[model samples]
Target: MKVVLINPPHTAIGSRIPDDHLPPLGLLCIGGPLIDAGFAVALIDADLSDMPLNRIVEEAANREPDVVMLGHSGSSSAHATVVALCGALKQRLSDLIIVYGGVHPTYHWDEILRDSPCIDIIVRGEGEQTVVDLMRTLKAQGDLHAVRGIAFRDPQDSAKVVETPAAYMIRNLDEHRIGWELIDHSSYSYWGGKRAVVLQFSRGCPYLCNYCGQRGYWTQWRHRDPVKLAREIGRLHREHGVELINFADELPTGSRRMWRTFLEALIAENVPVLLVGSTRAGDIVRDADILHLYRQAGVIRFLLGIEAYSEATLTQIRKGASVHEDRQAIQLMRQHGIISMATYVVGFEEERDVDLWRSLRHLLRYDPDQIQLLYLTPHRWTPFYKTAEHRQVIQTDTRRWDYKHQVLATRHMPPWRLFLWFKSIELILQLRPKALYRLLGHPDAVFRQSMRWYSEMGRRTWLREVFEFMFKTVRVREGQSLKTFLGPTLEAREYALEKAKPANSARRIIPLTESR
Candidate 1:
C-alpha cells in the first residue's frame, strides 16, 4: 500500500506570526509505523510554506498514493481547512482513501463522516497503531469493522456511522520510531532561524484539569525510554544540524524521577541544543533541586500552566496547583537561569473589568520571564464543555476555535470590550519595564535573543489581531447557546481513558442516534 501524510496549513495567529515552523510530530509518528509495515509512505508538510488548497491537492495528486492521511496539532482551528483539502483531493483522485485524524475528528467522528463525503475514515484517539491495522485491512480488502479505533460510514447504510472498539494505548512509546527521514531537516526551524523539531518525551497527563482535551485523548500517562530519547535528540543535533527541540508532551515532567533521569541523560549527551516545552507549575517547584540540570540539559524555558490565579478558581477547574506553587515555580526557574513562561488563561469563569484588573495584578506579582494569555476553548469531549454548554457562543466559525480566540460570551461585557481587556493584559505583561529590561539587557546572550525573538513575534501578532478583530472578523450579537450550536456533549462517547477500562466496568458506548 502507498500512503501520504499531509499537515494542513493553519490560520492561528501563532502559526502565521513566526518565520520558522516545526515538523508535525503526529503525522511523522503515524508515518513511521506505516513505513515499517512495508507501505510506500511520503509526507507533504503544507504548513512549512502555508501552501494553498490547490497546491496541496496538486502535490497529493502527484504522489499517486493509495491513501492520504491528514492531521494537525492545532486540530480544532485547522479542521475547516482539512475538510476543504479532503474535498479537493477527492475531486482530483476519486479512488484515493482519505483518512482524517486528530483531537477534533476523534470525538466529532460521526458528524465529520456524515457531513464530509470526501473523508473515507476517521482514525480516533491515537493513530500510530490503528492506522497500521487499518492499512493492512484495506490491503487485504477486509472489513473495516474488524479494525479497532476507527469510524467510517456503514457499508449497508452510508448515512450511518460505525465506530469500532477503541485501540489500546501503546504500552511503550518506543514501540514505533518517528519517521524523521520523511522531511528535510533544513526546512524546519524555531527560535529565530535555529533548525528545530518537535519531539515528545511522554504522552498524557496524570492530573485531570477539567477543560483539558489532551488528557482524555491520550488515555493515561506514559513515557519513552529516557536514555533512548536523549540519544535521539543528540543524534538529531549532531547529524541533522538541528539546534532546537520543542517538546510536544502535555506534561513532560509528570513523573519527577523520570524527568530528572531524562535531564541527566540529555546532559550526558553534551549537546548544545535549546529546549522549550510546557509543564505544570507544581512539577517545577517539586524539581527545584535538580533545575540546574535542566539548564545544563538545554531547557531554556518552561511554560507553566498557571491557568488561573484565584485558589477557588483553581479548585473549580481541578488544576491541582495552588497560587503559592505558581509563584514559587517562577522564582525557582529564574534562580536556575531557566526562563519561565506563565500561561494565564482567561474565560474559565465570567470576568468583569475588575476581574481582568485582578488577573493583571496577579501576573505582575508572579513576574515570570514571559506570559501567554489564552482563552478557554471548551471541547465537546471535555468535562468543561458541560459547564459551558449553555453559554452563548460569540464566534460561530470553527476556524477561530483556537484558544487564542474567545468562543464563549461573557454576560459582563461585549466581545469588543473583552478583546480589549485581553489585549491590554497581554500588552501590559509583555511591555512592562521588567519584561523590557530582560528583553534588551539580559546578561546571557542566548536568553536575551530568545526574549527578543518572542517579543517581536508577539508584537506582530498583537497588531495583526487588533486589526483583524476591528475589521476582518465577525461575531454574532445574539448567538445560539453552546449546546444548541454543538449539540449534546460527547464526553461520554469519546474519552479514551474511559474506553481503556475493563469491558464490564467501562461505560457502555452510547448509540449514535441517542440523545445525551
Candidate 2:
C-alpha cells in the first residue's frame, strides 16, 4: 500500500529562513510499522513547505495515495482546518481513505468522522500501532471493525458506528528507528532564525488537567529509556548538525532521575543544543540540581501551565499547583537563567472580573520572559469540555476555534471582555521598553527592521481592514484566503488561524497520538 503522511501548515512567526526542523514523529512512528511491513510511504510536511489546502489537495491527488493521514495539535483552528482538508481531499478523490489522528481526535473521534464524510477513520489514543494495523487490514481487504485502536464510520448504513483498534504499547524505545531517515534536515527553525528541532523522550500523562484531553487516553505516564533518548539527541547533533532541540513531551522533565540522567549525558556529549519544552514547574524547583544540569545541557526555554492565579480557580480547573508552588517554580526558572514562557487562562467558570485583573497583575509581577494568555477552551473529551458543553460554553462559529482570535461563549465573562483584556495586555507588553529590548535584542538595528515590517502591513490597509472586520464578525469573509493575513498586520489575528496547523513539522516521529 502506498501511504502519504502530512503535517499541515500551522500558525507561527512568518519569517523566511532555512528549515532545519524535525520531521513529523507521529507520521513516522506510524510509518515505521508500515515500512517494516513492506509498504511504500512518503511524508508531506506542509508546515515546512507553507503549502495551502489547494496545494495539499493537488499533491495528494498527484500521488494518488491509498491512504492519506494528517495530524493536528491543541489549537482548534488547526484541527478544523485538518477536518476541512480531509473533507476537500475526499471530495476530489472518492477512493482515498482519509484518516484523522491527533490529541483532539481521541475524544472527538466520533464527532470528527460523523461531522465529515471525508474522514473515513480516526486513530484514537496512540497511532503508531493502530495506523499500521489499519493499513494492513485495508491492504488484505479485511473488515475494519476488527481493528482495535482506530475508529471508522459504518459505511453500510447512514448511522455512524465506531471501533477501537487494538493497542500496542511501545515498551522498547530503541526498537524503533526514530525515523531519522524521514526527516529533511535543511528546513527547521524557531522564534526568528533559531535552528530548532524536537525529540520526544516519553509519552502519556499521569495527572489530569481538566482542560486537557490526555486523561481520556492513557491512564499513566511512560518514559523512554534515558540512554536511548540521550543517544538520539547526540546523534542528531553529531550526525545531522542539529543546533537546537525542543524535547517535545507532555512534560520533558516528567521523571526526575531519568531527566537528570538524560541531561548529564547531554552535558557529557558536549552537544551545543538549546533544549525547550513544557515541564512541571514543581519538578524543576524540587530538583534544582537537575535544572542546573539542564542549563549546562543548553536548556533554554520552557512553557509552564500556571493556568490561573486564584487558588479556588486553580483547584476548580485542576491545575495541580498551589499559588506558592507556581510562584516558586517561576522564580526558580529565572534563577537558573532559563527563559520561562508562562501560560495563564482567563474566562474560567468560577473566575470573576477582579480575578482576571489579579491574574494579569500576578503575571506582570512575575514578569517572565514572555506570557501567553488563553481563553480557556474545553476541547472535546476533556472534563471541562463535557461540563462546559452542557453549560453553554460552545462558541458561536467554528472559526472561533482559533482561540486567539475569538472566544466562544465563556463560563462567566463576556467574550468581548476576554478579547479586549488579552488585546490590551499584548499591546501593553509590546510597548514596554524592557520587553521590546528582549524581543528585538539589539534596539536600534532591530527596531528599524520592526518598523519596516509594521509599515509594510500599514500599506496593505484594505487587507488589514478585512482582517479586523473578520475579528469583529468572528466570521471569515466569504472566499477569504487566510494566507494574506499571516504576517505582521495580522500578527495576533493570524496566530490563532495559523496555530491551527500541527507542530509535527519540527520533529518527524511525533504522531498525532502524542500531539493531540
Candidate 3:
C-alpha cells in the first residue's frame, strides 16, 4: 500500500517564518509506523514548503496513494486549511480516500463528516497507532468498524457515526518509531541560520491548565527513554546536520531526577544544538539547583508560560502557578545565561485595558529576554471552550485562531479597540530601550545577531498582523465564517484535577513525577 502524509500550510500569513520552520512531528511520527508496516510513504510538509493548497493537492494526487493522511502538530488553528485542502483534493480525485486527524478534527468529527464530503475518515486520538491500523484495514478492504480510534460515517447509513474503540496509548515510548529519516534537515532552522529539527523527550502535561488542548490530546504524561533520547539528539546533530532541536513536548521537565539525568547525558555527548521548548514557570524555578546543566545540555531557550500577572486571572484560568514563580523563573534562566521567553495570553472574557496595563507592568518587571503575547485559543475540547463557545467570535475564520490573532469578542471593548490595544502593548514592550539595546548594541556578536533576527521576525509579523486586522476582511466581525453556529455551548465539567484523563478514564498513565 502507498500512503501520503501532508502537513497543511498555515492559514495565517504572519504565523510562519520560512527559515525557522520545524518539521511536522505529528505527521512524521505517524509516518514512522507506516514505513515499519511495509507501506510506501511520502512526506509533505506544506507549511515549510510554502506551497499553496492547489499545488499541495496537485502533488498529493501525483503520488496516487491508496490513502492520503493529513495531520498537524499545532492543529486547532489549522483546521480550516486541512478541510479546504481535503475538499480541493476530493474535487480533483473523487475516489481518493482522505483522512483528517488532529485535536480539532478528533472532537469536530461529526460536523466535519456532515458538512465536508471530502474527508472520509478521522483517525481520532493518538494517531500513530490509528494511522497504521487505518491503513492496514483499508488496504485489505476490511471493515473500518474493526479499526479502533477512528470516526467515520456509516457507509450504508450516513446519518450514523461509526466511532470505533479508542486506540491504546503507547506506554514504552521506545517501542514507537519517530520518522526522523523522513525529514529533510536543510529545510528547517532556529535562532537565525542554525539547522533545526523537531524532537520530543516526552508527551502530555500533568498540570491542569483550563485553556490547553495539548493535555487533552496527549491523554496523559509519559517520557521517552532518557539515554536513548539523548543519543538520538547527538546522532541527529552529528549525522543529520541538525544544529537545533525544537522539542514538541508539552512538559518535558516533569521529573526533576529524570530530566536532570537526560540533561547530563546530552551534556556528556557534547552536542551544541540550541534546544528550545515551553514549560511551566514552576519547573524553571524548581530546577534552579541544576541551572547550569540546562545550558551545558544545549538548552539555549526556555519558553515559560507566564499566562497572566494577576492572581485573580491566574485562578480563573487555573494556571497553577503564582506571579512570584513567574518572576523567579525568569531570573533563574537569566542567571544561567539561558534566554527566557515568557508567553502572556490575553482575551479572557473579563479582560480589559486595566488588565493589559497590569500585564505590561509585569512584563517589564519580569525582564524576560523575550515575551510573546498570544490571544486565547479556546479549542472545542478545552475547558475554556465552555466559557467562550457562546460568546461572539470576531475572527471566526478558523485559521486565525493561531494564538497570534484575537478571536473572541470582548465584553469591555470592540474588535478594533482590542486589536489596537493588543498591538500597542507589543510595541511598548518590544521597542523599549533595553530591548533595542540587546538587539543592536550587545557586546556579544552571536547574541546581538540572534536577537536581531528574532526581533526583526517579531516586528515584521506584528506589523503584518496589525495591517491584517485593519484591512483584511477575513477578520472583520461581519465577515465571520461561523454563521451556522447556534447557541448552547458544549457543557464541560472539570474532570478530577488529580486523575481521570479526558475520554479514557479507564486507562491513564500517571507520570512518575508530578511533585516537582
Candidate 4:
C-alpha cells in the first residue's frame, strides 16, 4: 500500500506568515509507524512548503498513493481547511481514500462522517498503531468496523457511522519513531535562523487544569529514554544541521531526576542547540538549584503557563501554582539568562474592568523577559466546557477557534472594548523600555531575530483584529451575541472553583494509564 500524509496549509494568522511556520511533528509521528509497517509513505508539510492546494494536488497525483491522510494537532481551528483540502483531493483523484485524525475529529467523528463524504476515515486519539492497522485493513478489504481507533461510514448505509472503541494509547514511547528522512530540514526553522525540528521528551501532563485538553487526551504521563533522546538530538545537531529543538511536550519536566539526567547527558555532548519548551511554573521553582543544568544543556527559554496573577483565578482553573511561585520562576529564569515567557489567559466569567488593571499591575511587578496574552478557549471535552456551553461565541467560524479569538461572553464590557483592553495590556508590557531591550537588543542574534519576527507578526495581527472588530460583521453560530459582533451571557455570574479533591478525583481507583 502507498500513503501520503499532508499537514494542511493552515488559514490561521500565524500560518499566513512564512517566518512563523513550524514543522508538523504530529504527521511525522504517524509517518514513522506507517514506514515501520512496510507501507510506502510520503509526508508533505504543506504549511511549511506554503504550497497552493492545486500544487499539492499535482504533487500527490505524481505519487499516485492509494491513500491520502490529513490532520492537525491543533484540530479545532484547522477543521475547515482540512475539509476543503479533502474536497479538492476527492475531486482530483476519484479512487483515493482520505483519512483525518486529531482532537476535534476524535470527539466529533460522527458529525464529520455525516457532513463530509470526501473523508473516508478518522483515526481517533493517538495515531501510531491505528494508522498501521487502518492501512492494512484497507489493503486487505477487511471490515472497516473491525479496525480499532477509527470512525467510518458503513458502505451499505452512508448515514450510519461505524466507530471502533477507543484506541489504546502506546505506553512505550520508544516504539514510535520519527521518520526524519521524510522531512526536508531546510524548510523548517526556529529562533530566527536556527535550523530547528520539533521533538518530544514526554507525552501527557499530570496536573488537572480544568480548561486543558492534554491531560484528558494523553490520559497519563510517560517519557522516552533520557540518554537515547540526548544522543539522537546530538546526532541531529552534528549530522543534520539542527541547531534548535522545540519540545512539543506539555510537561517535559515531570520527573525531576530524569529531566536532570537528560539535561546532563545533552550538556556532556556540548552541542549548543537552543532548546525551548512550555512547562508549569512550579517545576522551575522546584528545580531552582539545578538551574545551571538547564542552561548548560542549551535550554534557552521556558514558557511558564502563568494563566493569571490572582490566587482566586489560579484556584478557579485548578492551576497548581500560586502568584508567588510564578514570580519566583520568572526571577530564576532571568537570573540564569533563560528567557521566561509568562503567558496569561483572559476571559473568565468573574473578570471585570478592575481585574484587567489588576492583572496589568501584577504583570509589571512580575516582569518576565517576554509575555503572551490569550483568550480562554473552552473545549467541549473539558470541564471548562460545561460552564461555557451557554455562552455566545463571537467568532462562530470554526477557523477562529484558535486561542486568539475571544469565545465567551463578558460580564462588564463589549467585545471591542475587551479587545482594546487586551491590546492595552499587551502594549503596557511589550512597549516598556526593559521589555524592548530584551526583544530588540538581546545579545544572541538568533533569539533577537525570532523576537523581532514575532513582534512584527503581533503588530500586524493587532491591527487586523482592530479592523475586524470595528468593521467586519460576524454571524454567531448559535445563541445571540451581546452585540452584533461579540459573545452571549454566561447565566451564572460570580462563580469560582472550589478547591480540587485530589488527582484523579473524578475517576475510579485505576492507575493513570493508556486505557483510562
Which residues of candidate 2, in runs, are more than 4 Å off?
Answer: 10-23, 74-76, 155-162, 165-168, 350-353, 390-394, 410-414, 427-516
lDDT of 1 by residue, 1-516 (tens): 889999999998889888989999999999999999999999999988889999999998888999999999999889999999999999999999999998999888878887799999999888889999999999999988888888888777776778777878887899999999999999999999999999999999888798998888988889999999999999999999999999999999988888889999999999999999999888888888899899999999999999987999999899899999999999998888788998989899889999989999999999989888998888888888999999999899989998888889999988889899899988998889999998999898889999999988888999999998999888898999999998878879546633353553211233445454
Alpha-carbon TM-score of each model against the true structure: 0.97, 0.80, 0.91, 0.89
Per-residue accuracy of model 2 over 1-516 as CA lDDT, tens digit each: 889888887643221122334556677677777777777888888877678899998988888799898885533556767877887888888899888887666555555665677888877666766777788899999977777667776656546455543344555555665555666675766433455566778766666677765544554466788877777778888887777776668876778888888888878887877777888878877887666787788877788888877788778878787877777887887677677777776656545577667766787766666666666654544556444444342334554454444434544666556656765665554456755555466344433343333334323432333356345555322322212221111111110111122433221122222222
Shift in Å, residue 288, candidate 2 = 1.5
User: Candidates sorted by lDDT, descending order?
Assistant: 1, 4, 3, 2
Candidate 1 TM-score versus the reference: 0.97
Instruction: Extract clashing residue pairs from model 4.
Output: none
Identify the candidate with maximal lDDT: 1
Cα RMSDs of all predictions?
1.9, 9.5, 5.6, 6.4
- Could you tally the backbone clashes for each prediction? 0, 33, 0, 0
Question: Candidate 3, overall lDDT?
Answer: 0.77
Residue 264's lDDT in candidate 3? 91
> Would you list the clashing residue pairs of candidate 3?
none
Q: Higher-lDDT candidate among 1 and 2?
A: 1
Write the number of the candidate with greater lDDT, choosing between 3 and 4.
4
Per-residue lDDT over 1-516 for candidate 4, one digit per residue giving the tens place of the 0 to 100 score: 899999887666656644645678888898988998899999877887567888888888899989998988678888988898889899999899999987777766666777788999987778888899889999999877666678777676665667666666677788889988898888788765678999999988878888886666776788999999999999999988999999999999999999999999998888978899999888999999999889889888889988887798789888888999899999998888788888889976547788888889999999987778888877656666666665666567768777777776575777777788888988788889988987878887655665676677677777776676677637443545323332222212111111223333221121111121
**Model 3 bad stretches (over 4 Å):** 441-446, 473-516
